[model samples]
Each structure stands twice: as C-alpha cells, then as structure tokens.
Target: SIYRMNFAASLCKRVNIRELVTNVPAYAGATELSGGGLALVFRRWATKKTAGSTKNGRDSNPKNLGVKKFGGERVIPGNIIVRQRGTRFHPGNYVGIGKDHTLYALKEGNVKFE
Candidate 1:
C-alpha cells in the first residue's frame, strides 16, 4: 500500500523529496521560507554497533555516526515546477492531496505524525 511504502521511505536515514509543478525549496534547505513553492531535502546518517566490545565480539550499544543531506524535486499534476523536497512520505506521515504533505517521525517501530 502507498501508506506503508511512504512509511518505509521515511525510515531511511536520509531522504530527498520535492513537490511537483513549482520547484520551490521545501524542507531541509535554506533558512528562509518560499511560502508557496514546493521543496525537497535529503538526509543521511551513519551508525556504529556499540561503544564497547561484547562477549560475542560485537558492539552491544549502538551510536549515531554522521548524517548528510541531499536535494530532490518532483512534479505535481501538470505544472513543471522544481520545488524542494519534503520529508519522506510515510504511513504516519500526512498523505493524500492538499494539506496531506507532512511526514511523521518513526518511534519504537511505530509511526507518529506531527
């Protein structure tokens, strides 16, 4: 289903999303807001198993290594606009048309939209 797919995409450490039609910079880019243009941004992250060695020769504790950002764009309906990408669409994220453009963050294997 689209909802599940969107949720999986959001689970990715880094993602780039853009609105169709107008190529406006959206989330993850620029400090200022464009108001009516779509935007897309990419985010990336690295992780480590643990800080200490375990009996199984593996790190039991996990740690965040680093993160990177990328840019993306998409077209809407018929307009050929290049907007910044928004958060990766997810099940918990806002889906559908019009005001359904927000993605919810995932926590404890569950999705929570803001």
Candidate 2:
C-alpha cells in the first residue's frame, strides 16, 4: 500500500493528474494507464491476540496436611493421628509428636482430643 502511495504521489507530481483522479467514483477500481491516475483501497485492521500461558510455576504443590485420624477412631502404635506444620494439636496420653509437629499413636487405643 505504501509503495502504491509513493508511486501515485510521484506520478501525480510529474503528470499533474490529481484533478482528474479525485473526481472519479470510488467503485471505478483502477484508472487508465495514460491518465496517470491512482486508486487506493485500504482494508487492514487490528485483531484480538490469542490466549497465552494460563498456568504458572509460582503455585506450590499441595502438602496434604491435616488430621489423618478422627476422635474415637482406634489406632495402633506408629499410626499417624494428625499431620500438621505447627503445634495446632498437642500430643496426649499414648500419642507422641514428631519433629515436624505431627502426632502419632504410641500404643493401641482410641483417639481423643482435648
């Protein structure tokens, strides 16, 4: 389109045919070569961009942290009673706390909470 405009501008400057081309109907399409006229059609337009990455690596994986055994549930020694990150629930009686604050059964018994 720019090339056509430059060619038309140069031809118009050299031949002095702007007066004749300006009066022609838009639907006429092209002009006679001898007339040294220009017919321009512009139809380019902006469009919406496609979707990019919807997921990211900033999100961490699930830790699966929570109570594993409920109150009144029977558990043997070494059975996990609760999985936690802090002292949310303190161990009592036959239960023991792990280094990461998890609670496990130390002997066979029913679970309890206080």
Candidate 3:
C-alpha cells in the first residue's frame, strides 16, 4: 500500500506539479485536480463501491419451540412439558395439550413420557 501511494504521488508530480501541492499526505484533495485528460487516469484505480445485494434475503423470528420438560423431571400443574408446532407427543394421564399443541402438566408429579 505504501509503495502504491508513493508511486501515485510520483506519477501525479510528473503529470502536474501544481496538482501535487494539495494531493500529498491527503489524497482527499485529489478531487480538485480536474482535466478530462490522462491526469485523471488515477481515478479509475480508486476504490469502487461494493455492489448491493440483489437477492431478496429475509428471515423469520425464532419460534422457540422445543421440549421444556423431559421424562422423570418434576413438574407442577400447568407447567409446560413440551412446546411444539404439532402433536409430536400425545398428552398422557395428568397431561393436557394447549391450542398451539403444547403439552402441559395437569397435576403436580414427576413427568412421564408414556
């Protein structure tokens, strides 16, 4: 990068000494050196803007769906046993299923899958 900057400086000096007065140490001033000629060739080497993404990328919020209580785990009444999108696990004795198909406990006891 240093070599490229030095080369560009020298090239600019060779092209026009007046242009170098403001360009050195701060190429930001290079924009002033205007001429529809070869001096403006360095502009082509300047950084190009990154291409914007064209794909319609999107993502939905996580549902946080999963088992909340495993078998043999202690549970209180109304405690969620499983959170799922469908009837993955049927509600057994002392268990109940919610409108969203989530299984919950109906009584205080150790959770059982069967």
Question: How much lDDT does each candidate structure score?
Answer: 0.37, 0.81, 0.79
**Candidate 2 residue lDDT tens string, 6-108:** 9889876755556545444434445433343554444446788988986666877999899999989999999999999999999899888999999999999
Evaluate residue 93 in candidate 1 and report its C-alpha lDDT on the 0 to 100 scale: 27
Q: What ordering of candidates by lDDT runs from best to worst?
A: 2, 3, 1
Off by over 4 Å in 2: 1-57
TM-score against native, each model: 0.18, 0.50, 0.51
Query: How much is the lDDT of residue 46 in candidate 1?
Result: 75
Q: Candidate 1's residue-wise lDDT over 10-108, tens digit each? A: 876463443323454434457554545454444556777778756675566753221111123322333212122443432322222223333222222
Candidate 1, which segments miss by more than 4 Å at Cα? 1-35, 51-53, 56-114
State the weakest 10-residue window (summed lDDT) of model 2: 26-35
Q: Who wins the TM-score comparison?
A: 3
Relative to the true structure, candidate 1 has a C-alpha RMSD (angstroms) of 43.2
Ranking by TM-score: 3, 2, 1
Q: Which digits, one per residue and each the tens of the lDDT, describe model 3 over residues 2-63?
A: 99999889876655655434332334355555544434223336698899988677888999
Residue 74 in model 1: lDDT: 29
lDDT of 1: 0.37
